[model samples]
Target chain A: MLLEVSAEKRFGNFLLDAEFALDCKRCGIFGPSGSGKSTLVHMLAGLLKPDRGKISIAGTPVFDAARGINIPPEKRRVGLVFQHSHLFPNMSVQANLYYGWRRTRKSDRKIGPGALTTALNLDHLLKRDVNSLSGGERRRVAVGRTLLACPRLILLDEPLTGLDAELKSQIMPYLKKVFTEFDVPMLFISHSLQEMRLMTDEVLIPENGCCRKRMSTEELARSSMTSVPRSYVNLLTLRRPQAHNDIWIYSWGDEKLRLIEPGEPGDNLFELGASDITLFKRHPEATSARNILPCKVVEIFGSGGRVGVELEGGGGRLVSQIVHESVRELDIQNGSELFAVIKASAFRKIC
Target chain B: MLLSPQDMQAVWLSIKVATTATLVTAPFGFGIAYFFSFARMPGKYLLECLVNLPLVLPPVVVGYLLLLFFGQSGFAGPLLKFFDLRIIFTLTGAVIASAVVGFPLLVRAIRIGMDNIDIHYIQAARTLGAGRLDTLLTIILPLSGRAILAGMTLMFARSLGEFGATIILAGNIPGVTQTIPLAIYDYANTPDGDRMAMSLCLVSIALSFAVLLASEALARSFRKGSADAP
Candidate 1:
């Protein structure tokens, strides 16, 4: 199904001028915090009215402010799993499931209880009170309840936010299974790139209050095509050079120069890492490494058994992490006279 | 001591009043709560304030207000007259008073319960293709049992102890219009019936205690559910 949303809304100082069509079965709505991702979902689900726009899913008109046509959430056939799963407290897992079942009109023409509940592993929890279920289990039941309604489209609004990482990992497979098993298309919202990787193939990144662009997660993650992966972006190693659109240009070797896109013109940042590099880093002695001045090894930092070496590259700061074993075997020290490797391929196409 | 016919009449009347008030207002009360909690409506704030008015209004004023409307030649008097009905100073009038006083409490408790509910479930249900009323009847209602039950208890307690409004609108007519609270008031006014008044006092206290206990229990469970679900 193709879901379209074009709207204008303002929440206090936050303005939302977003428009996007999601064609993928599973797509991620990605953005930094307060990027209007949830606002977009709210508009889709009929929870919030847009000032102007038309939203249609598979040609069903969900919203059209100009025409004054706004479908109520239930009629829109858009299921939403919230950041917080709002299971009905008074009902048992079984009752909650049945609640969704009873609301469906068989004549409206799709799905059955047995298929949905069994798919979500809600059968065992059916008899249990919703209050007694664990967070993970409640989410499962909530998803089950929504699916049992047999919606045409599903929207998950940061559905895994309060979950611990382990819980998130544990539930990730079930979410994948639910997506595939239920045959329902979904819009998954996430702020973390790590989470976006596990959830969807298509990624829609929201910047400011609007969607900047949409692409495949792989394409999004690739260093050359996109700057999604931290390991992919180019890190400038020169002491100083010309600045362009907040990007700094640095010579890697005689021929290879890389661009470091640092966002807007005025913002300044200190200390960058090779892991933060989107593309490549290399150290060369050419008349080209001519710009590469003498450097100094500064410090090393890592977590959970990894090591990152800090260096002063020709008076400019650069960082590259090494395996603990590498640091030990290579005799790398605080003042080691090793080159801070820089590469040309490390430059990513930042849109 | 053996049960007296007066006590029996009062007990029966109390049940009748409480049951009728609950039966008539529950579906509407829950519906109002659901709407107030979830729906985007024009004049919703006005409606919310109206629904909650009784909670803050003195029961006597509420009774007085009902009397103004339901009394003979009053605003609604002619409408009920079409059916040969009279509300003032009758058992039905007592119910009207009880229900009015209890309604705000019932709706507030239920609304708060519903407000605490994540609209996600309903949204999920909608996507699942359930219609508006269907979601309300099934998921919303069943899921909010604790809050609704709490509302029910509050309504019953308020109705049982209802005096100011019941006395004003329905008046105290022993064995008919006189509920337990009214009965207690009448007996306690007489020198020889002090013991009877004390007995009624003990009964009201006990029932209120029972309702309070049930309220606490439901509240505890409500908290447990909130913690588990999100």
Candidate 2:
């Protein structure tokens, strides 16, 4: 879906003037709180009218102030999942899930209720009241409810904002599964870099009520390394875990790495901080760390006092964060070979 | 049990008038409450003031205005004449008076209910492909059911004890427009009629107590229904 928007809206002291055009299926609007991320979502969904501008979805003009055209939200076919699951209090889980499906035109109903229930794992809770569900279950049902509408584009406005860490992890996989299976275009909005990396490929950064930048999700994450407290977070997709006595062994591409934490079978995502990987000029013997690999320095580029060493080894790539002084002492440069040491316990499973 | 045939007629007429007034006012009450709670039209505060004027003003003053409006030379006089309807000194006039007098209470209750509902629910329904009227009927209306019931109960109780308005508009006819309060008023005015007046007062209390109890029971059931799985 191609979403084109050029709109301006003012709420007293705050004015949101956004102009952008995106054609990606998975796009994100990333910004801090009160930076007008939600305002843009509301405009796209037709819940909040833009003061003066034009908005078109897939070449259809949904809103054009100059042309005197403004479609209502129900006719726009732009579904939204709010932060809190605002499921109808009077409806059962089944009723809430099908509320949109029942209203969608037969020709437009691409996602069926049965398939949605199975995908969202909501079949067991169909007979339960909405208030009885847990936070993660409510979010799953909310996503299911929106998907059943078969919208042209779905907007998720900080859908996991208030959830705890464990609940957030539980809901992310379902979100990924739905977008993949249904092939529906979505605009994911959130402030967390981790969520953006996991859910979207490209991101639009909104600041001070305007979208100032548009870049790849990886570029955005890397740029934040200098400012974010965590330095840099390396996302690793590991699979085929085997129990190795006291530890778990996982395969990364063609290389096997031992981890202290055990993971379930199949593909698992883990976050290893760039600061956690210690670089050595030569292979160090008798170290307590379990994982050590000889890697070639592919690139060395960063700002501020910290430098990022891009490593290519273990049949994959990893970035190690180190101080500038260390870079000089180790004489690190492009195409230089080094040993990267990491403790097995440093790997944190995200999902 | 302690009254004449005319007293019995008055007792039955009170129930009929109160029931009719409450039923007729319910839909309009809900509509006005919705408008107040959600609509963003200009001059809304003015409309609100008009709707709530009867609540603060004296009921006798409300009846007097209705009397003139439906009188021969009043604003609605030509309209009533066109429809060949008589509103003054009739049971219909009693119902109109009761409805107008109790309207503010009913609207207040429903508006509170609607206001308490989260705005996101309405937005969610709209994005989920439900139109304006569809959302109102399916979401807003059902969510505020208890509030509507409470409003109706308040209106019904108010209509049962509606004295000043009913007396002025429908008059104190013994077997026609006289309700329980009007009957009690008559007995209190006559010589050696204290027993009849006291008995009618007791009946009024019992009727009001019954309405309150019924509303409580209904509200409890509504709560349980929403909590249980379908």
Candidate 3:
């Protein structure tokens, strides 16, 4: 395992009690606001000490309250990319990136300044002061700085928050590039499902200051989190796109789904909630919905009197919520062919 | 009018003592400020209060305390004499007196600057593998530049104007330990010494104003540099 953390802390009324072990090179912690996601990661990074428990990174015990061992953050060799870029305002971009790089032991250095500067496209930015960089640029610099530190694991605490869609997109690719090019492990934290889906394959979900569940990102993308059983949001990766005034047609196998939102040129994927889809045993005719896909039922799961039907149609997969009575009446089962209908407004871009 | 030789000597002596005191105390002040800014030691508040005691204590009481510690009959006197060094009633004594009176102002200004720095920056530095001292040298010191300048200015001005402590310890020995304040005190007490006293008072005010202006300029540049940085 790359990391294992079992710790408990209390902050006034909030209690952060979480325990999880991660082996994946790129894992994510997904939760809503105040879910103790940040607190958990901060503990992992050794920025915040656990009141009582243990944290081990790469099999090295960074914190063991029972043994009275709490390694300092600098000695932990775990890098942190804060939600707000904490680039040294007094230093140039180059200096900030090298601040940790220079301090890292010669033998311990894996990623060098030259490699990071190139991967992050920090050539022109090297001489610029950090305050002058745009939000996207600052985030990129923060990533580069962390990477150059040669950390065993990198913890990103909602790094994409406080950014507009355009800037987020601009910085997202660089993050992906850095993660791919560098060999360091990364634990991403975010409240946005779309961001988690984009960045991680394994996810740890936090609830009320505790890690409640650990699941694959793909599984998380399919599950409906809301209590409203009538609707369950299902996410999909957008394939080839063809724009048609106010409507963007996305290819799904031999079928095409029309999205009502204005499509940006380079949008990669989109989300469609299960509640937005209606299942028909036979193809419907003359409906106001812009999308009708012939599909087969893959699985049926029940939750609180409602049945969630997973379907595969054309080239994509979707989940739909149907009444339990309908499931018994239609005799839905695995491989039961059906048609799924989606309205024009049902699809939203994921950036 | 041109000052008499004795008064000019006093002005020069004050300048030398105050400048030396400020320069000597600044680094120590920054170190204490940095410690107070971050460390979580027990009795940290007590340490802070002790460091700040001079700012509240009467100047004569501080001088008396210093005399008890460093005077010929005090505990440190033998240790000092072992090195053939004498501090009492010398220019060094005058510098020490001014510094003790102004130490709190220096540390307070520096602490304010250190407090203004975002904790996240220090945290970031640590996670990036920079140790505490490394972070302080590269991050805290550079970022707290403005505060340090302000503290130094205040300390310098206070040292220049230091009276009660200097009189008590340095004994107003003209051309030896007597600074501008002591000289002014002497002139104010002597009959027909009014003109000289007034002239020295104006000189002191002008000197303090110049120091304040220079320090302000330095602080503004630091602010501007950070604001205009990327």
Q: Of 1 and 3, which scores higher on DockQ?
A: 3
Specify the CAPRI tier of model 3.
medium
- Give one digit per residue, the lDDT tens place, for model 3 in A68-183: 99999999999999899888888889988898888899999988788789888889989997887888889999988998989999999999999998788678777887898887
Kindly list the per-residue Cα lDDT of model 1 for residues B51-151, writing each as its tens digit.
Answer: 88998998999999999999777999889999999899899999999999999989998998788766666665665556777777766776677788889
Which model, 1 or 2, shows the larger lDDT? 2
Residues A224-313 of candidate 1: C-alpha lDDT, one tens digit per residue: 222332442223333234565655654333322345543233212222335542111334545321123345678766542445566665
Q: Candidate 3: where are CA atoms >4 Å away?
A: A10-15, A32-34, A66-69, A112-122, A221-230, A243-247, A253-255, A260-267, A304-306, A325-329, B224-230
Q: What TM-score does structure 3 among the candidates reach?
A: 0.91
- Once fitted onto the true fold, the runs of candidate 2 whose alpha carbons sit more than 4 angstroms away are B224-230
Q: Which candidate gets the maximum lDDT versus the true structure?
A: 2
**Candidate 2 residue-wise lDDT, A256-337, digit = tens:** 8889888879889999999999999999998999999889999987865878899999759999999999999999999999
Model 1 lDDT vs. the true structure?
Answer: 0.72
- Candidate 1 lDDT score at position A180: 86
lDDT of each: 0.72, 0.91, 0.86
